[model samples]
Target: MLSPSPNSSKKAFSRVALVGKFHADGIEDHLKDLATLVSGLGCEVFIEAETATHLGLSGYPTKTAQDFAGSIDLVVVLGGDGTMLGIARQLAGSNVPLVGINMGRLGYMTDIPFQSVKDTLPKIIAGDFEADTRTLLDAVVLRDGKEINRALALNDVVVNRSGISGMVELAVQVNGSFMYNQRSDGLIVSTPTGSTAYALSAGGPILHPHVAGILLVPIAPHSLSNRPIVLPKHSVTVIEVVNGLEVIVNFDMQSQTNLQSGDKIEVRQSDKTIALLHPSNHSDYKTLREKLHWNEYPSTF
Candidate 1:
């Protein structure tokens, strides 16, 4: 585990929000402790509406994640990676900086573990943490070359079928150049930050968040030669539905839309970026080895 950054030399007043899985045991206690910890550092702590009810603290009187992001100076997410992703997608257009505190197993985005809260809190409250900015993707679906639906994803945009009969065929292209006509259950266009998510499950490469690239990995490719490819971050990729099969498009984990044959999805780097509060970015390779146990050696001595 990484150590926390030290507290800031100057005091600062900031609005902070806590997003957590209050259903988890001991989390309420931790929330209270965390709130008090930051409050003592001259920051105002805010809670989500229902989460406050669960914790018996003051309800925030708001429901949407945008409410918190639009109001606060910083957002603190105390759950697993899923929770952080959920919050990230919700606050996508709002451009909120997120600080993820891990309360679950195998958290890559949620770097600060529950045990490290005491050390991490003081520094984060004092604005001593490092900030890593990760860009998002803007994905829009079109039918007959007419606009239909649009969404933003911090992770990846997935196009898949719920049916079981035949594989979904996707015509993949990058900036008007044909990549391949792929036959698979789905297609994943993931950001480097998302390389560890569903893309990784589909045999995609693990890309560092700082890497300026996007990944297109096929899910169960029909041809043996179809391999995952990384594209320049600024490249515009296009995917069209083929094979006359019905499919669904997902923006990160939210916003699902149905697409028929001839529907097109254009993906590219979103103009905005998401800022992450980091204790340090010096050792993600270490995280890959330690937290994930990437490639361990047997006793050689």
Candidate 2:
């Protein structure tokens, strides 16, 4: 068990919104339990509109994502990292911090486990947590020099080929300077906070959250020499589709749009950021070791 900070006895967030993964089973019970506990702490609780609707929950106040922005002090998210990502992006620029209770696999950003929620949530609500501010990426899709679509991502922006399509030919540029032409399955532009996600699996290096950098990872390039590279946080990366069939650009894999052969994606760090609250005992290395099984030895001798 982790010990709380010395300030645990002091109240931190007086108003909190509970956001949960609507698709998960038995989520109502969890929300109810959380509401009971939170209200007992003398704090006002609001349920995210959709989650409340899905569970048909009554008695608790409900607020939409937009409504939560300036009204709430903190957001308590329950689910996997995907759920956290969605809410974080929705609530970006609000300056309201978020804490996650993990109910999914990998549980990277969703640090608190369900078994530990009771212990952790109270401590966090009482000002016993560490705060981390993470960067977001703003991406715009252009066709014929006209902006066709745009989105924001807390994890990564991926441009990839659709099913049965051949390798995508992409022309890359950094801050208006030509970089390379690559034939590959796809490309990933990840922020430091997302270094351990798709970028890591694509052979990109893990950048600590404090690093002010962006990562460009090639997804199985035709030429093995095309490796991942780190770019300055201010560098604007433009990826033009030289050729491909049914190419698609995804924003954190939550939203996507089809890309034309001449389409270009412009990606850059956004002015908005999301804050994550963790227990005082949280450690990035500890999370990596536990989540990636680094501390476990191989069973086969």
Candidate 3:
């Protein structure tokens, strides 16, 4: 769960779209069940094109992920965080809030559980939900001061070395000011929404979603003093590859682009954002305790 916005007048969602993790087991049956339920609520139900094709579902009208903007009132994603990340990026800045029904392990972003979606989704569809807006990272690859590649990431932008390569050397700068030069396996520039993800796994601190900051975490730094740091939300970070072979830059680990020496990766907070809708009862702290297993200890102690 994310920190929820204030409760507002519930807006009726008459048009709803469903996206599923087609690779997940039993997805077809789950989508069918949801379609029936949405229809029962007197709403028009649509299936995302790729999802429909994979499941061989043809009974419902199909739309591309891009087409869902301005067309659907709400989008329901039935998958894990990976699936949600993909759709969230596609729908970023669209103002079409997304609801996630978790069907994967360690669902940090996909907080809603499938077992409870039956009892929960109806309320959300009727506008009884909390909305949380998350910022996005816009990154571009620069070679000879020319833009070569660009992408938006809902999580962190990672600059890493290949499997067979040793530590890469990166020169870091913030807002055009020199920061540091370091040799490490990689570097992670993460948003608060991604603080709990790969950044955390790389020894980065877990920042609350509402926190206004960006995280920089080094992976296997050659110098022990090269630790993680948090930058102001408005700051722009630039990392130049001064050394290493097969270096690459990844946007949320979903997409990747090979990097060469002297190539600069420029990252900044995007003007756009993703809006996530949650059950009214959602609590960020409670979710952390549950998903991160903070509840494993004796509560009575």
Candidate 4:
């Protein structure tokens, strides 16, 4: 029911990668709807090859997220923000602009509403879009100076106690300066983009995405006096297990790795970044108000 932007050009690009998690209820139908819309726009729609079998889609060449990312100019992700994260990880270093259509809850990453795609898609194809270049964090676990596990997150990285009881002592440092040694449930080191996520849930404040800073929030400190602190972008937060107890480290609420006592964990902004495609002039406050219902006052009309 919406029209393309006035300046849309038909010769922009002819190929697209439609990525989504079709297993969720009602998602398969949404994928079909998206494909139809893309087709109507005159672009050749290629479902991520591997996703074909799961979605039971036919007549289109199926490809893995990796393979499809290599051949497409744009990637349209369906479902929620988490689904987009899964797909975007595959497109890292590929420089393919990603558009996320929110079909899930708390879709901070996938901020676009499903119904708005009618107008949104056209604007994107015409290159009438904005890009948010988000820095990714890379965490590498070392076992006696040898690389064990390495991963990236658009959100935060957490290191916490394994069992429900008892507190773990964490030695915190920033750029080689010692901060504190505290006993708490865990610790969260989040980027500005992740400030509103789990970090907020653990009593951290919301930071505008443009802020070149990181948040170091302690989760339920045993002393009750410890509070969250913001550090500069050029800083590095190094965590060490001072008490020689085993603990778990979670990356972006997805994957995890366990670091034994005496192991050192270093976290820093990655040289790599994820580029998100926005529709231009989009304000961070606007999204916060809309998504969080900031104006939903109790007694307002």
TM-score of each: 0.87, 0.94, 0.94, 0.89
Model 4, CA-based lDDT = 0.79
User: Alpha carbon lDDT of residue 233, candidate 4?
Assistant: 81
Model 1 accuracy (lDDT, Cα)? 0.79
Q: Which lDDT values do the candidates have, in the order given?
A: 0.79, 0.90, 0.89, 0.79
Better-scoring candidate (lDDT), 2 or 4: 2
Residues 37-70, model 3: lDDT tens digits: 7777777899999899988998999999999878
- What TM-score does candidate 4 get on C-alpha atoms? 0.89
- Cα RMSD, each candidate: 3.7, 3.6, 4.3, 3.1
lDDT (tens digit, per residue) of candidate 1 on 1-301: 2232344434433777788876777787777777766665666678866567666865233344658655777888888777777777767667678888887565777887778777766676666677888878899999998989988888999988877757999998898899899989889999988898899999999999999998999989889788999999889999999865668899886678998998999999998787878675335776677776778656693
Candidate 4, position 182, lDDT: 88
Model 4, span 1-301: residue lDDT tens: 3334454456355788788776778777777778877767777888886567777887656667767545888888887877877777667677777888887564777888888887788777767778888877777776677777888877888999877647888898889999999899899999888898889889999988878888889998988789999888877788887763558888887888888776777888887777888877666777887777898445653
Q: Please provide, for model 2 over 131-153, each residue's C-alpha lDDT reduced to its tens digit, 9 standing for 90 to 100.
A: 99999999999999999998999
Q: Which candidate number maximizes lDDT? A: 2
Which scores better on TM-score, 1 or 4?
4
TM-score of candidate 1 versus the correct structure, residues matched by position: 0.87
Model 3: runs farther than 4 Å from truth?
A: 1-11, 104-106, 296-301
How many Å off is the CA of 292 in candidate 3? Answer: 1.3
Q: Per-residue lDDT for 154 in model 2? A: 93
